[model samples]
Target: MTQTAQLSPSSVFVVSGGAKGITAECTIRLAQQQPCKFILLGRSELLETEPDYAQNSDESALKKCIMENLLSQGEKPTPMNVQKIYNKITSSREIKKTLAAIEKTGAKAEYISVDVTDTPALQEKLATAVQHLGPITGIIHGAGNLADKLIEKKTEQDFEKVYTAKVQGLENLLNCVNPNQLQHLVLFSSVTGFYGNPGQSDYAIANEILNKSAHIFKQSYPSCHVVAINWGAWDSGMVTAELKKVFQERKIEIIPVAVGAQMLVKEMDNTNHATAQVVIGSPLVPQATELDSELRTYRVRRQMTLEANPFLHDHTIAGSPVLPATCAMTWMINTCEQLYPGYKLFHHQNFKILKGITFNESLAKEHILEIEEISKVSFENVEVKATILSKNPEGKIHYHFSAQLNLQQKIPIARPYESINLEEDNIITTTGKAFYQNGGATLFHGPAFQEVTKVLNISPEKITTECLWQEISDKQQGQFPVQWINPYTIDLSMHALWIWTQHFHQEACLPGRVEKYEQFVATPHNKPFYVSCEVKAKTATSVIADFIIHDRQGQIYSRMLGAHAIIWSMKLLRS
Candidate 1:
C-alpha cells in the first residue's frame, strides 16, 4: 500500500480520540496532506488559548490527568484554579495548533468535546456534522483510555475507561452516521489485545473487539471501507518517559507519530483490496517470566466488558443480561491455555454459576468484567474465578458474578455443547429474530438478543438448534473479542427449549439459574456455530434442560448443565 493515498478535497472526516497522542498527530498530518474538513473530538474540553500555568514549571502530565479526573467528578472547576485548568489549557494549545495546521493546508477543522459512549450526545454531534460539513465520508475511530493494572487489582471503572471510547464509541459512530455514504472506518486498535499482556487484560480485550468489528462491519456495510490497525505503543502523547522505558524493556518498539499517520493514509486506500485488519508494530510474546510478583501466584487474571463486548448487553432475563456459566469457563480455560499452550481444556469439575453475572447497562457505565485465578495450578489441572468488580468512591472493591472453574486433563470428549457438525443443507434454518420479535420481548430480548440461527431438531425428549453468532448490526452493538456467543446468547439459546415446550406447555419459560456449566474449549467470534438442548427434568412450576455451543468441525466451545427455568407470562407480537 502506498503511503501517498491522501483524501480528496470534498472529503469530510469525523475522528474520536483525536485530541492528543498519536491521534492528534495524525489529525494534523492528514489535514496537511488531504486538506479535508475534519471534526476532532476529545473527552476533555479545551479552550482557544493556553493558560498561565502552561508556562509554569509545575505543570506535569500526571497533574493534568489528576485535575481532569477531579473535574470529571465535578469538584467545582474554575480558570482561577490554574492547577485544575493548566492540563486542559495545554491540551487546548495542542488542539489549536493542529486545527491551525489543518487550516493552513486550505482545510476546515473544528473541535467538539464529547464522550463517544454517550449515544445521545454522539447523535447530536452527528447532526452537527451533517449541518456543517455535510455527509460524513470518513470516520477514524481513534478513541481509547488507559487503565493498566493486574487483572485482580483492576476495577470495573478501569475497564470502562478503556472500552467506552473504543468499543461503544465505534457502535455509536456506526449507528449515528450514514453507513451507506461512509467510505472509511479506521479503528485504532492495539497489539496487546491480539497477543496477551500481564496487566493489560482490559486493554487487550478492548482492542481485540475492534479487530473483529472491522471484519464484521465490512461484511455488514459493503459500501464502507473499514479496517482496524492493531498499533504498537507510540513515542508521543500517551507514552510517558517512564512508560517508554518499560515498553523498551518489554521488546516493544515505539511507532513514530509521523509514520503512523502515513500508515492511516495507506490503509484508507483499501491497500489489500479487502476490508482487512493489520498490526503495525510487534510486542514480545507473553511469558511466565514477565509476570510481576503480584500476578505470579499461578493465578491469571483477564478483564472484559460491553464496550468491546456489546453482545453481553443482548441476552436479558426479566430485563438484564446475565453471564452464562459457559462464558466463565471459556475465560478460565483460555487463561489456562495461555499458561499451558498446545493443550485445550481436557476436563472441568465443580463448575457452578454461583450467581448470574448481570451485564446491566446502567451498572456497566462504571464497571467491567474481571476473571482471576484464585488457586495455583495442580499438575495437569487449574482453577479460576470470574467477577464484575469495581471500586467505590472510598476506594474499596465492589464485586459480582462470583463463580469457580476447575481445569484438568485426560478426560472423555463426549459431552454437551460438543457435537458433530450438522451440514447446513440438512439443518432447518430459521431466524431467531422472528421468534423474539414474534414473541418474548418480555423475555427481555430485542433483535440484538436473538441468538438462534437454525433449528436442527425438536421432539418431546430432545431439541436442537444452531446459536450461530451472525453479528447483528442493528439497534445496539457488541464487542468483537468473542468467538462464541456470550452468556446472554447461551441463555437466550435455551429459549429454543422453551419454544419447543410451546408444543405442550403453551407458555414461555425463563432460565431460573444454572445448576452447572463449564467451557470445553475457547471459541472465536467470527466462526459459524450451533447449540443442542436435551430435556433433563420437568415439573409443575419449572423445567431443567442441558445445552451446548459448538462449531461445524464439532469443536465444542461451551456447554451448559441443568439449566433451570420457570414459567413466565409474556405478551407476544407478530408481523
Candidate 2:
C-alpha cells in the first residue's frame, strides 16, 4: 500500500492509499482545494511502482480468484495474509504523487508506514503523524474489505479477518484518538450492513459491525461527532472486474464514489446532531431491510382504514352514564345559563328537589291551589299556590291559581235617647219631639200628636253600624236595606288579591311552553291566563304551552315565564 498527503504549510490532509483508484484520486483533489497538509499512510512497496502500471492488470482481480482456488484445493486461506493482500492491492504510487502536487501548493506532505492489524503500532504511528502535521481535527476511517462467500462456505476465520480489519480498525482509531481535539469521525459502511445479500455474509457482518461501532463511539464520547456513511455499490478495485461482471449480470448499478464522498462531507458540515446514518443511492431505502418491510406493512393497513366508507364506522354516544331525561335536563340548564344569565330556575323554591317528582301523575291528578292572607292595614296580601305540572327538563313543575279578598265592617251600635228634667218643669210645660236611634235606625216612641211632654233638652241621636258584606248583586242594595258604598272598594280589593295570587302562581310554574307565555291568552280586561292545554302522546314525553294575560294598556300581555305542563292524562287516555 502507498500513502499520499496533500498539504498547505499550516495543515495536512492525510489520505491512506492515496495512489489507488477513484477513492485516492478524490481525496487528493479535496486536499488540493482545502488549506491543509497531507500525510498518506500506505505500504512502501506500492510507492516504488510506476504510474502507468503499478501492478498487473489482473491484480484487482486477485482476491476472489485466489479465494476460489484455495477453496477448490480444500485449503482455507489464512486470515492475516488475506488482510495483507487486501491492503496491498488498494495502495498505489501515482495516487501519492497526485496528492504531493496538492501539497506543493503552499502545503506540506508526508507518508507513514503502518499496519492496521497491529493496533499499538498503528496508534503510535497515527499519533506521531498528528504531532508532525499538527493536532488532528478530523479522521475518515474509509479502510474496509469485502468477501463474497456464502455463510455455508465461509469459515469463521473469514468472518473474523474482515470484521477485525474494518470494524476493529475503526474501533481502535476511536479509542486512540483524543476526543477533545477531534471534531468529526467519519466511518464508511456498506448498504450490505443494513440489507443482507445471498453470498456476502462476511462482508455484511463486517459492515454492520462498523456501523454499530460508530454509534458506540458516539455514545462513549458525546461531544465528539460521529457519522456512518452507508455507501451503495461503488465502482472501485474493491469491486473487482469479475465482481463487476457478476453485478452487471445481476442488474446491480454501481454508484459513483464522488457522489458518496460529497454526501459524507455535506453531512459532516451539518451541526444539527452529532451522529447520523446517511445512505447514498436511494433516499427511500431504509438502512435496515427488516424495519423497512415492517413500516410498509403498517402503512398498507393505515391506507385500508382510510379507504373504508365513513358511514360504516360506529359512533356510540360518549359521556357519563345518565338517563336520557336527566341528560336533557342538564343540557337545558347549561344552555339556559349560556343564553340568559340569572334567568335559570335552579334555585327557585319550586325547582328544589328536582328529581323526585313524577311528571305524569303530578300534572294530571294534582289541582293547583293558592292561599292569600290579606292585611287591611297595609292593603297587601300574601298568596301561595300549590300544583303540579309536567316536570321541566330541569325537573321543575308549574301551577296556576287566582285569589279574591273582601274588606268590609259588619257590626251595628245602639244610640242613646234625649233626657228631660221634671222637678222645675211642673209649673212650666214644654212640647218636644222625642227621638231614639238603634242599630243604624231612627225612631220616635211614647209621643202623641201635640203631646204636652216635659222635654228639657234633646240631642240628635247617634248610631253606628257595621256589616260583613258578601258579594252581592249591584242592583240588590235596596232589597237588603243596608247602606250602599262605592262598589269599586270591593272590586279593588279583589283585584289586588288577584295580582298577589299571580305572583305566586308564576313562581310555582315550571319552565316550559305554557309557562313560557306561548299558550297564555290576553283578555279584554287585561288579565293574563293560559287558555291552551298541551297533551303529550307518550308517558315519557311532555308538551309545552305559553300562558297569556292582558295588560292594563290593552295590548296583548305576555311574558316568557317558561311554564311547561306535563300531560299526566297519558294513562287515562290510553284506558
Candidate closest to the true structure, highest TM-score: 1
Error of 1 at 181 (Å): 0.7
Against the hidden true structure, what lDDT does model 1 obtain?
Answer: 0.65
| Per-model lDDT | 0.65, 0.40
Which run of 10 residues does model 1 get worst, by summed lDDT? 287-296
How well is each residue in 93-140 modelled by candidate 1, as lDDT tens digits?
A: 777777777789898888888999999987897797679787888889
Q: lDDT, candidate 1, residue 416?
A: 44
The alpha-carbon lDDT assigned to residue 22 of candidate 1 equals: 78
Could you give candidate 2's per-residue lDDT for residues 215-273 as a string of tens digits?
Answer: 78667655556677787777765778997786765456787776655655566555345
Q: What are the models' TM-scores?
A: 0.48, 0.40
C-alpha lDDT of residue 145 in model 1: 79
Model 1 / residue 239 / CA error / Å: 2.7
| Model 1 regions more than 4 Å off | 1-6, 49-82, 290-337, 340-575
